[model samples]
Target: METPIKIDISVIVPSYNGMPLFKTSLDSVLAQEGVIYEVLVGNDSPSDGETKNYLNQIENKDLRVFHNEKNLGLFGNLNNLIKHAKGDIVHLWSQDDIMNPNCLLETVKFHNSHPNIAYAFSRVEVINEHDEVIDKTPLSNNDTMSALTHTLTSLMAGSVPGNIANVSIRKNIFETYGYFDVNLKYSGDFEFWCRITEHLPVGIIQKYLIKLRRHTGQLSRNPKMWIYRIEENDAILETLLNRVPKNKLKYINRGLKWRVYNQYFGLYLNLLRSGDNKEAQAFLRVIKKYSNISGFYFRYVILKILSVIKRDKKFLHWLYYKQAFGNNGK
Candidate 1:
């Protein structure tokens, strides 16, 4: 009989014509040290000849490539990859992102030390298309912050403490909590984090172990994608509100308003800048739908008027920063 493979981590890369960028991602995973891991690349029916040829040329013993009969979107491809993963832990890697050499080593060490933690994530380094480091994620390192408080507060503030590329979770968590909601386009990962955090304590590694690439092709950069994100986030917040304890109701409600206000305001600004008046008005309507607080509307009108008067993107951005973070920039 053939000997069974004992893989500690499975790094699943879901690709759809992500070539040039995909090669960088694959190379990083191959270079990971201090772990028995396998790299699985799921090609979502690449129609491009070059991408197909690239997949055909992969000959690594530790890497396996699978192709879908038809095109499955991001979450769909992720689900398929999960089904094929044979490792005890799974890391859903992004096709355009690069992993730090110690990503797997650090994540495995953390999980081993904290056997109770089902989900583990580390800090992220944000990079641009040219591979230049732009920013590092500001994930709180205060050990006093409870997992529930950290997760809820982050989500409510319209931010994620860690990106998907830096996350690793036990395979059993999926069997217990269910897989990613394939229907959600933008907030699926966000919702999954919220859900899993409710059931299991999350482990945080303060090191920057993943590079999240920001480029024009990224879905979040697409102006049209914000509409769907707003809708999905609203639904996610409603579900969270229902699950939160009564004692935490006040905090949850406050976070909800903050999240809604920021999302609507940002999208409204983007639409206005893009000269999409109709969409901008639609976003304003969404803002009113979420909150009747006079301050929210006051800021909306102020920003709209300022945008028209200045018509300078940089000045408008400065104005937004001043209003949102105060003049001292804190």
Candidate 2:
């Protein structure tokens, strides 16, 4: 009698409005080699026959599909999928992202070699809607680091481990530390990373193991969600600030201010250009609240002035990209 392959990992893809790209995403996942794993796709779009029909036609024995009857949004679907996942380690993947062939193999190897780590992630190649590589994220050398280091790095670079597609977590850890907060629509992943790294060490796989697709339809790019994004970011930064020692608190605060400026300032401009006055004002209030942090006021003044000029908008845009991606707007 032949023995069944022991499933050590479950790649749970929470899918909704995830087609065309979902086909490519699932294909990359199904192509993963050198590991005995199962793919569990939570079809949040139960009413969408295209996604449902496509999933039904796939013949892989390792793939299992389930329907949600109704849409549960992103984190809700992820939470539901985690409950049904069978592997000790769960890789919660984005529906539009593609995994490298060795993503699962390399992730499994990292976890096996370091059993103490509750969470880990890898670098990503940023791709546009057409699957053409546009840019890659900065490399992380922190194969292992203390909780303090992880939190500090997160404050500085904003989710230092890269995309949620590359993140792998021990399923058991969810039971202990809690699951992704469905309340946060935009910054939930960043908040979750902050929450977990507070108690446990997070490791980096040091390879570009995923392709994070950037498209106009993604929720992160929506100007309508800016209010929620800033609110959640404020809460997350406050939580992290409370955890730091007094001596290091100032440095973390500085990094937090710069991160807010670098990350959302452009989005604030977008909201203004799109005539989302209410959201733009809300973002301004956030900047004003953080303005007490020494040099932050000057940053706000300079960016606000530069944002007014037609020619300087490009400089401000490049400045944001350079700081955020670290590749000089590649």
Question: Which lDDT tens digits does candidate 1 get at residues 1-330?
Answer: 999879988998889888899888989999999999998888886576676788789788889888777888888888888888999889889889999999988877777777776577788899999999999877675422345554555545543554678878888888888988988988888888787776566777878889999998887778777777878888777766666667656645544454447556777778889999998887777666776647676656665666688753444334432333233223
> Roughly what TM-score does model 2 have, to 2 decimal places?
0.84
* Candidate 1 structure, TM-score to reference: 0.84
Off by over 4 Å in 1: 139-147, 292-295, 299-330
CA lDDT, candidate 1, residue 284: 73
Give me the runs in candidate 2 sitting further than 4 Å from their true place.
Answer: 1-5, 258-266, 285-287, 292-297, 301-330
Error of 2 at 133 (Å): 1.4
Candidate 1 lDDT for residue 47:
74
